[model samples]
Target: MNEMQKPVIGFTCGDLNGIGLELILKTLGDHRLLEICTPVVFASNKSINFYRKSLPDINFNYASGKDFSRLNPKQVNIYPCWEEEVAITPGQLNETGGKYALISLKEAAQALKAGHIHGLVTAPIHKKNIQSADFNYSGHTPYLKDLFGVNDVVMFMVAENMRIGLVTEHVTVADVSKHITKESIISKLKIMHSSLQKDFGIDKPKIAVLGLNPHAGDEGLIGSEEENIIKPAIKEAKHNMLVFGPYSADAFFARGQYERFDAVLAMYHDQGLIPFKSLAIGEGVNFTAGLNAVRTSPDHGTAFDIAGKGKADHSSFMAATFECIEIIRLRFGYAEMRQNPLRKMSARILANAVDEKIEETE
Candidate 1:
């Protein structure tokens, strides 16, 4: 693709002390990545040079710019967000690292809103250190929700063919049950359904909803959430799309049931993440669905323990970059298809008839 045709992907330097820059440098170092997208790193030249000096094996060369007007497709571009002198202590957590991380994120978010960049790939951030008077959100999903003026979003994680979404993210286990209401379940299902069709390019997506309790509450023996809230929400959601089961989380993955569905919705964070991480491991990417703009991040965290060791794997970060680009392209195609309402309606009706016939036979 040419310079203008290629998507300009913006990267946020998450916690300077963490492996955020390391992953970015390592992924972009391959040179072949530039052919797919024009990368703009939202950090100062000083930070880039610091990492380059430390890891002399990697090549870090890019054009320095504050905007996307002159993005070089052949070379990575450094968008100067913070130019002040800062200490570089890799693998240590501090307030200064979080401060710079937010600065980079804010700059890139602004550019994203102004239509300068097509998509955003955020590195992991230290949630506690990043919190300040100006930014007080839990993580990137909520932060981007408020930034884009969206009411709800889904924290969808992808690793190859396995796609898992959480109904309640980053909340305590005690609060998770309270948040798993019928409305919330339905809302998340809607987001997941739309994301599958528009972002992942699935025509008719099948989603499995996991229950809040063990054995899916054993059909109300252990907990009433499956019978009361989850089932009701799934019933209502089926009218719009194909949704099935408040399935037992353990057997769902253990028996390879996740392979049968396009996506799976877990009631809480760990329920979805534990299995996904176990299966996908170094290749998972977290995609924030239901946003006007495409935003993705590595599935793992800041990795403060392995920050400076040069041992942090870049596979997940690379997957996030590829996901962002693919989602951007898919969204374009989805928009074009949506422009014709008659065609969409015809397809929907035909699909429903086929589903009805299959149900009758079964």
Candidate 2:
């Protein structure tokens, strides 16, 4: 396919001090990806060359410019988020890194919002240093939620073995209970259902819900939230979806019960992530569900410990990019399928054909 034929994917370099740029360079350095989609790095050429020195084997070639209209289809492109060079101290978590990281993100977000980019794949960003009066979210999901003016979005973790969505993410344990409600649970279930069908192309997805308390509140002896809150939510969601749970988080994974369901919903962050990251290992990708725009990220934070050492793994970042491109394709296909004029007539046409065949056989 030609450059105009492939999807335009934008990458945000998260926390310049971390391994964000490293992963971007390593992942984009491959020549094969150019055939699938045109890759745009939302960082300056200087930053690219900074990390390029370490990985001497990987050929780093790209077109550098702020204009997305003239994007090179055959080679990587840079947005040059900043003109002046910024100090990049590897393994350091400081505002200096956060400053530039946020700039790249904002620029990329603007392009995405304006429809210049089809999808966004963000690297890891530090929650603390990146915080300001304007950006006050815990992470990307919440940040994008506010940017796009969505009421809520799901922090969905995807892997071959399991898919998990958090009811409450980046919330303190003390405040987790306050965040989850019957309505919230039902809302998350809807997002997962739609995402499975549209993003992953799994129709009629089966979802399992995990409880906030141990042993799923142990039949109300341990807690009442499961009985009073989660169960009711599940019951209501069952009206239109195949959802089951309020399962004990421990037994659910230990017994491999999640394998039966297409997706799993946990009451909070660690309840789902601990097992997902451990199981998915290095191949996991984080997908934001229930959003108008497609966004994905590596299922990892800034590896401050291994920053600039050329030791950071790019598998998850690569997976995120691939997932972003795929979702764009899936969403486009789903939209076309929904809007196809023949769709409404096809069901009746099939029924008549079946009836005619039955009559002929008889």
Candidate 3:
């Protein structure tokens, strides 16, 4: 596709009772968004229409799954997953809606692999509700990893100036220590390095590796994981990647140390995400790294409390959508620094010849 041709982004219908449909509908309502990419929602026609009734001011068309081949940027393309009637009540959770959400996700993934879409920007999904429907997957990251057979996948949450990656996700605090290893840390670092330079357009990105214990174990006084596991992993990763860390988690985030690095590698979920969500709030974007296809989603969960109230903010969803576009451009060679539509009128890729030469000697 040419630069003028808008990229196609496939979206999954998140929990029907939640705010997924509302946010997707509200964001795509803006006609200007069509200028960047075609937003396609894989969902049931009835559910979308039901949500539409709640959002009366938004203007967009919905297409059925059987007619997916005829999609255009002129309307919100809907790949219907179900023909049955759905009783979608705002702010309420139902088991019936859970089944349809999974169906839509499966169809979206298949279409993405078939080259029908450039990338996927998913809405928030409730793991507990999906699990109640007999879905065994932990979350989207693990499911996508299994779908593409990608073992090196890592989840990075982007919040303005800070980006955080978890070496082990969706596990208990007790199990987190056992999951940490030199190999796992090294693998995540490599992916983070590649993603910063390739996807995020960072050149020679510096990464901070946070320690698992307090005060970085105080040189083996508080703990030895820093010296025995984290330090060694950082040293070994230097052969192929640039990484420096084993900093205390508490002080690292509190002192705003993350701003100094392109990305920070955290030991577990809450260790990295607590501070990230505090800063990013509604503007955070969750991106899956080390995958052949680019996938991103809102960092927050399905807000069942305010579902259907028309109170959900589209900022995070919009951020994810824009991030997907940049990833597609970089991956397909459409997003060179000079061609980026989001940048200044006469943007130029900075010439870093001096830094390259200096680094060669070091």
Candidate 4:
């Protein structure tokens, strides 16, 4: 039997003033999670402790030092990005919170880049506050894309009921049409198709594409994107994948049509997220698909409304953390699956050669 491989997962403190660390602490409090993977959190010790006091129920015995050479496998490990004390004012959105959140994220990302960690599970970061000269993207999807030097990636929302991939995310509603093209649709479809196979372990996945307009453009009366751009793209993808429909978004979800397929590809953000978040009901995970590494985050954002009330639900955060470990395992299994085909092909060739030799001798 093969030995168990517990992946080293890196967790990033998204916003110092938000519930990011609160969720992380609650999830890591359970000793059962430590057996599956070693966690490395990128945040200051002061920042972690500040939240720990409020969450009296949680118990996370951790260690930190100048380096990660001698990490304890059974406890949470903190790699402090800032040595000096940080002023963490919970339930407030300020420049200090954004600055330190960026610091933690960059540190965690660098560790992930250098192969120090196997996967990343990020806490929620406020988009507007986390913007600057160095980080001016709409979300982590684009930032990681540019950082990893990847050409394209998909913002895939995963849940127990359905999985949704967006063609255009964080784009203005008015400009959503300008971004919709046959090529872009096909590209997102390809990424989603591969992710379902490798990341989610779905073989021969059936993907459904949603329309861009109401009533699916009423056959081009309301909008022409569905007929002109989306339909042709689905047809092109059908040559290689099991892709179907520029279905009307409203009626599709209203009648539970998403259950008929493995995944649904939405033209824009709300088209997909509205149904996904409603159905996920606090258990959704936002996975950045098509990157070289694995990353997942809670579908919900920094709930500034309920930041430090001790009322924050950690289910989505826990789901994201557990999903990160699962995807890492699935990816290894997928790599082994790819190698098996070659071995089988080689054996078949050898068998055919032996049969030819026997025939010649007879």
Candidate 5:
């Protein structure tokens, strides 16, 4: 595709001390990626140079700019967020690294809001170090939600075929139960249903909802979440989309039943993530659904142990980038289809008429 036709994807350099920069560099170094989308990294030259020196084998060509007025599709453009002299201690978590990570993220998010970039693929950030007066949020999902003024969003994880979305994210085990109410469940179902249809181009999405307790509370024998909360939510949601089950989480994945559905909605974090990561480790992409914008990130976190050693796997980061590009295209196509439903119906009828005429002539 031409440069104008391709979407410009903005990337944030998550925790400079971590493997964020390494993964970003490794993924963008492949020249073939440029053909699909324009990539702009929101980071500084000093940070990129630090990684380049650490790993001399990986060669990346990039353009440096303060703003994206003139973008070079041929090279990865580095939008300088900061240019200060800071310690570069890889694999060691410090406050300085967190500061830069937040800066990179804030700059990229601003650009995305202004329509300077089409989509965003954020690298992993250190949760503790990144916390500050400016960024008091728990993680990227909530931060993006508040940044764009979106009230509800789902933390949807995607692998090759297994797609999982969480009803409650970044909550403690004790708090998980309190959050699993009928209203919360129904809201998440709506988000997942819309995301599957629009972002994924699924005409009809089959979502398998997982139960909170063992064996789906043994049909209310073990717990009443299934009877009182989950069942009622699914009933209400069926009017909106094809939603089924509060299936037992254990048996659903063990029996390969999840493959039957387009996506799975788990009650909490570990319920869905444990199975997803176990199957798609190093390849999963975390996609934030039900937002006005498209944002994705690697399923994994900052590997502080192997940050500077150049041992970080870039597979998940690469997958996240590819997913972001694809979702953007899918959303555009879905919107176009929605805008001209009559045109599509008319074409379908014309095709049927042509087939009937051919049959008569034959």
Candidate 6:
């Protein structure tokens, strides 16, 4: 037995208007979820119960703050962020919901640092709906980073067995080039590398880097970025990593070459995410790597239109939960090999076939 103690994971309800609340409620309805790890939701109990009653065939016997210690994995536990008097309407955005969402996130981050919880899995939050009274940071990642005063944070989405990390995020398309400097790429790469090795338990992980230009700047004809920017950064970063490319973005994903590397470092958000979402939409898990504490969320955003429709899919939420466990295991030093079990077997099979081919030639 691994004897690895089950970790307590914190959940943040993102935007009340979005399906974040609905998905959180649905994902917890699975009674078997408790057996894997203890889940603590940081949201209002009123919102939670209202959603449960509104949806049919959904049952969550959520434990409140006073009843936290008595919590068992077979049931759900919720840490109330505000009183029940607060009125909440499905598909409505308000300052109250924004305040509550930020409160939950702050509390969860605190609990993680205090060792009260092992990791965190946040529900989707609306960036625009949130008001200044609750938060001043750009996004959850930035807020958490500032709260912890820790640098080196990266966001990656996992789905279809592909992990993609971004060099720039949450900015206009025009600003992407200016942000793609050697320092920026190097910093993001460092974060990605450490996350894969320490938080993801990938020893000597191979990273695939993409070019900023089309067809990798077509040898400097189409764009100068490949020669002046990306290539030089890769050259410097290579001394500390087994990194490859400045590969053409168009063909790298199409040829399935990305699977060869532990992670693909894309120069911009769309550069990496277009292919990722295309392959893993609705099932992709968004992971915030290189944080002091583990945090993940569904790859998609809050679906305000589908908030109370009972139509939101919980697949991405489930993946985020499972990915949290994997990260927990990695941090605890339980992942023994660089390749996960499935990947190790595949590597062995490929090596054996190659040996047989060589023998035949001899």
lDDT by residue for model 3 (1-362), tens: 56577788999978888899998998888878887887789887778888888789998675555554677776678877778887786676777557767888888888877778889998877777777433677799988888888778899999778899999999988888898999999989999998887788676777889999888888889878888999999999888766777888888878877777779999999989998988653488999998888899988888989999888988889899988988888766525544575552332235244233212110
Per-model CA lDDT versus the true structure: 0.89, 0.87, 0.81, 0.88, 0.88, 0.78
Number of the candidate with higher lDDT, 5 or 6: 5
Q: How would you encode candidate 4's per-residue C-alpha lDDT over 78-177 as one tens digit per residue?
A: 9989989778888999998899989999999888877788899999999989999989999889999998998899999999889999999999999999
**What are the per-residue Cα lDDT tens digits for candidate 6 across 1-362?**
14466778888888766787788888888878887888899887888877887677987787788344565555577888777576777777777667667777878888777767888898877787675765776577777777777876787777757789988878788888888888888888898888877776555667888988888888899879889988899899989977778889889888877767779999888888899988653478878877777888888877777788899988889889888887887776634444378765665566456531111100
1-362, model 2: which lDDT tens digit per residue?
22247989999999999999999989999989999998899988888888899889888899988777899999999999888978889999999888888999999998888889989999999999999876788888888888888777899999888899999999999999998899999999999999987898665678889988998898899979999999999999989988887889898888888777789999989989999977664489999998888899998899999999999999999999998998888887667667776953563465456431111100
In model 6, pairs of residues that clash are 34-73
lDDT of 1 by residue, 16-81 (tens): 999999999999998898988889999999998888776788987899977577778899999999
Clash pairs, candidate 4, are none
True lDDT of residue 139, candidate 6: 75
**Candidate 6, overall lDDT?**
0.78
Q: Which candidate is the best by lDDT?
A: 1
Alpha-carbon runs more than 4 Å astray in model 1: 1-4, 340-362
Ten-residue stretch with the least lDDT total in model 5 = 353-362
Alpha-carbon lDDT of model 3: 0.81
Score residue 177 of candidate 5 by CA lDDT: 93
**TM-score of candidate 1 relative to the true fold:** 0.93
The TM-scores of all predictions, comma-separated, are 0.93, 0.93, 0.90, 0.92, 0.93, 0.88
RMSD per prediction, one decimal?
Answer: 2.8, 5.7, 4.4, 7.7, 5.9, 5.0
TM-score of 5: 0.93
